[model samples]
Target chain A: MTIKDIVYIALFVALTAALGLMPPIAFAGGALPPITAQSLGVMLAGSVLGAKRGGYALLLFVALVAMGFPLLSGGRGGFGVLLGTSGGFILAWPICAAVIGHLVHKNANANIWVTGGMIAFGGILVMYTLGIPWMAVVGKLGLDKSLAIMVAYIPGDLVKVVLATVIARGLRRAYPNI
Target chain B: MLDLYTPGTSMLHRMSPGPKMAALAIAATALFLQESLLVTALAVVAILALYRVANIPMKTALAQIRPLMWIFVIFFAVQWYFSGLTLAAYVVLRLAALILLASLVTLTTRASDMIDSMTRALRLFKPIGVNPDKVSLAISLALRFIPVLGRIATEVREAQKTRGLERSIIAVAMPLAIRAIKMADDVSDAIESRGYRS
Candidate 1:
């Protein structure tokens, strides 16, 4: 409600959008292109904003897309894309945000690695679970192929998870309130 | 570096985070289910109206979207080239709508309030072996760090530029990485000192 909160929220929204500009990993012959640095923003939202606010930040981003802003990576947007092949992943943003927030809040004083892993795994599950089904239905791929394509994303996502964890933990050290 | 949120006092802002989230979920689902251009167009119009109702400044909204112009162009081109113009148009317009709507939400709500709402939602997961507290903490940490990382990145870039090493990835990246590592260590210590548990 205060000016500071408004300022921070605005900053995070821009940060999330800007980070989306990071080049996505293009896998040859895969069902989907795994975006690099995508989850970094997601993790950042949760870790910094805490459980509820973190998810809200992401929700804010998703709402923008629903309202027709081309803020997603690669300039994709609109309701149609949401129904397209990657709709599932798009839909998973809020859930992932909540999961990341919850994990970090619960282990507020835990080791960075454990907290990081929890957030990463939670994110991975949300994206993949939502993404695979859409891949199957929209892309017309079977479960096996959908799973295979989804699997290609794990390595790249893991790297993001680690980075998010490190950066978040580091920021906490630098600023106690965060 | 860009501030995309426009301050507003729309009904959306007054709406609780929980209901707003639910609405988004429902709308997103509807979007995915309806592939008709008519439906998509309607959705776009509805989002714009929400912006108006929310009292977001038009100039501010447009400015927020300006940076993304290039991405939209690239996507339009790629989709056009590979999937034809019609599909490209559809995809671009749809994505644009979503982004704008999200901007509206962020512009109105406070980050801390959003965090609290999420923590409450996840508390239901406690019975499923999930700890809402820990999860929320991690999310808070990540969200809080985004700006810090951005600041660190900018500082590193500036430092590199001063030495005429701006063009070198190593010059910018190395220090950023080092600082990030140091940051992680500090976070762990702070959490422990605060008497919080993992």
Candidate 2:
């Protein structure tokens, strides 16, 4: 990789950390509950950086979390987190980013709707495919229970897909070669 | 900019990064695997004592756990609801012990020393196409950028708020992405100017 590639990767990693600082957004009288802004960072990394580099960026972020930086939402990190209930979701970040990046790369020049679809597929579908089952096993809540709990976050995650799609489209327009 | 390391001459501060990291991993795993609540509570007290030994002030130690207060409360509530008070207490105590142990490592080790140890550890993968130097540089750069990007996020949020777009995620996200990309370009150029080839 060139110096530019490294910078891009590092930049996304930092972006992920920055997004963790965002306060959780609560809606629907707390029935739907608060959803974290951190995962939006994963979507943005992939949508902006593309597969390999995006994956690397998230991988590096996870490594830093493992290294004891309180980079995760609510300033949680370390092996304690990786072994916790949401460990699967945390571990799936790199793969989730790569999946979104790969789809975005294929759909270059696509419209907003198409981009949103790809983000939803890769970010939401791919992530929960790994995350839910892991939550079930780690939390010992069973698959059905885990799915039930995690489903509530989908609406919030969809909002992130839309936001990432819009931001990535604007980014492409501003810097065509990026 | 927000480095957790505190310079000192304590035993933990003098310990090498590799062994300290290893000890943390082992201790954390052991804490999780054990089933005794009393042992976990003792471990928490032990970690606090170690913090005192390392001269980390009580306020600083409390600060480390502050951001996680809500998370702990949620976890405790849920666990209590499902498994009763004892199980909940065990879970939270174990978690606190693990987090404190991990933070202790970061508190004592310099960022450069930690990165150097990682680089040295990664050298074993050199034959598998890993470039230890580049990986180390990327890790360090990512660490350095975390606080900088955090400041940027704050600035972008305020900038969007002035335009009456404070509640819009897109408004803040767009500016943040653009600024981050620009910064990346400038950083890469600076690195290249300094004779960095990769």
Candidate 3:
């Protein structure tokens, strides 16, 4: 990796953590697990930074969270969250970004629509695959119940995928190297 | 924002980052292996004792574990219903112990020092053609970037709210992401002009 790569990875990690500091998109007064916008940053990382760098960026973000930085959604952090209901999704984020990047960027012929589709699949499908199971095991909800709760997260993520696609397209157009 | 590491002269604070981290890793895993609440309760007591020895104030200690209180309550209630009270006690105690241990490490060690340890550990991967220096640089960069981007994103969110577009994911997300990329480009250009090559 060059100095440029280092800069990009750090920038994306900061971007993701920054998004976490913003208020949650869904305003439910902190009762339910309302939708957070940080996942948008994860999608943008993969879509804009590509797989390897994007994955590294998220790995850094997660590492900081594990280190007790209040960088997660709602400004929550520390190792306890790894055992919390959200731990699975938190752990899955790096993989989700990598999958999104790999699927969308691997093929030279892949178009905007293809990228959008892959982001949805990778960010939503793959994330929940790891997340729901972990939620069930840690939160002690059965797999079926975890799925039911996770469904609420889909619409927000789909919107994020569209947002990521537009930004990624614009970024690639302006700075093709990304 | 929760800058946890308090300046102190206690043994924990004086200990090298590597050994403290190793002990934390061991204690964290051990809390999981044993299902007995008795063991976990004892472990929590030992951890609190260490905290006292470390000069971490009770207020600071409570702040560290405070956010977890509600989650612990909910999980305990769930465990009580689905499993049993004994299991619930064990689960909560184990989680508390692990979280305290992790927070203890964070409070004692500096972030830069942790990054140094990370770089040192990654140096073992040099034979695989990976650049540990670059990886370490990236790690440090990520740590520095968190506050910068957080400020930018919050500003964007407020700006979007004025236009009543805050609820629309694209309205807030687009500007935030676009500005982040723009910032990245400027930084990349600065790095290039400084002649930093792989």
Candidate 4:
């Protein structure tokens, strides 16, 4: 990787971590739990950085967490997070970003629908595949129960996908080479 | 902005990050592997005692667990409902011990020391075309940029608020992304001009 690539990767890592520091926004008059902006950072990482660098950014983020920085939401970090009930989702982040990045890169002239679809497929479909099963095993909840809990996150996650796509699109227009 | 490392001359503070981290990993695994509540409870007590030994204040140490309090409560209630009280206590207590032990390392170790140890460990991957210096640089850069990016985010939000677009994600996010990308390019140029190489 060039120096620019390294810096870009680190920049996205910080961006993702900083997003965690933003207060979660409650939607639907607080009927649903507040949605975190951190994962939106993941979607942006993939859509903007492309597959390899985007994947590395998330890998670096995870590595920092393993090294005990309280970068995760709510200042949670360390091996405990990697081994927690939400471990599945956290572990899936790098792969999720890579998947989105790869698809977005392939469709260089992607419109809103294409970008949103890629984000949803990678961020939701790929993430849930790993996160749900892990939660079931770790929490001792059955697969059905774990899936049920994850359903609560769907609306919020979809909102993030849309937000990330719009942000990515704007960035692309502003800096086509990015 | 990232002053989690508490200054001290205690044993834990003096201990190197590498061994402390290794011990954390082994101990955390043992905490999960063993199914005995008594063992886990004793581990919890031992971790608390270590905090004292490390000269870390009770409040500072408790701060590490406070953010996760609700998570712990929800987990306990769910586990209790599915299994029993004993199991629930075991799981939560074990989790608490793990978090405490992990936080203790961060609290006692300097960020530079941790990065140095990581660079040393990563040297083993040199045979695979892994550049340890670049990796370590990226890590430190990411660590340094975290607070900067956070400040930038706040600045963008405040700027948007004046235009009555503070609540609009697009307004805040678009400007933030553009600024961050521009900053990255400037940093890359600055470093490159200073005789830095990839």
Whose TM-score is greatest here? Answer: 4
- Candidate 4: give the clashing pairs: none
CA deviation > 4 Å runs, candidate 2: A27-34, A137-145, B144-168
Positional deviation of residue B91's Cα in model 1 after best superposition, in angstroms: 14
Candidate 3 colliding pairs: none
Q: Write the per-residue lDDT of candidate 1 for residues A28-147, one digit (tens) a residue.
A: 553345455666777776776677667766776675454344557765444444655567887787778778888887888989779877877667887788778875665434567668
Residue A47 local lDDT, model 1: 73
**lDDT computed for candidate 3:** 0.78
Q: Model-by-model lDDT, in order?
A: 0.65, 0.83, 0.78, 0.87
In lDDT terms, which candidate is top? 4
- Give the per-residue lDDT digits (tens) of candidate 3, residues A27-142: 45665456777888788788778899889888878877876677776656766667567788889999999998887788636787887898898889899999999888765568
Best by DockQ: 4
Candidate DockQ scores, in order: 0.08, 0.58, 0.54, 0.68
Q: Candidate 4 lDDT, tens digit per residue, B37-146? A: 99999999999999999999899879988877766777788789988999899888877888888888888988778888999998999999889999988988898898
**What is the DockQ score of candidate 3, to 2 decimals?**
0.54
In angstroms, give how far residue A133 of model 1 lies from its true place. 1.8
Q: List fnat per candidate, in order.
A: 0.01, 0.62, 0.60, 0.65
Q: List the candidate numbers ranked by TM-score, top first.
A: 4, 3, 2, 1
Question: Chain B TM-score of all predictions, in order?
Answer: 0.74, 0.83, 0.89, 0.93
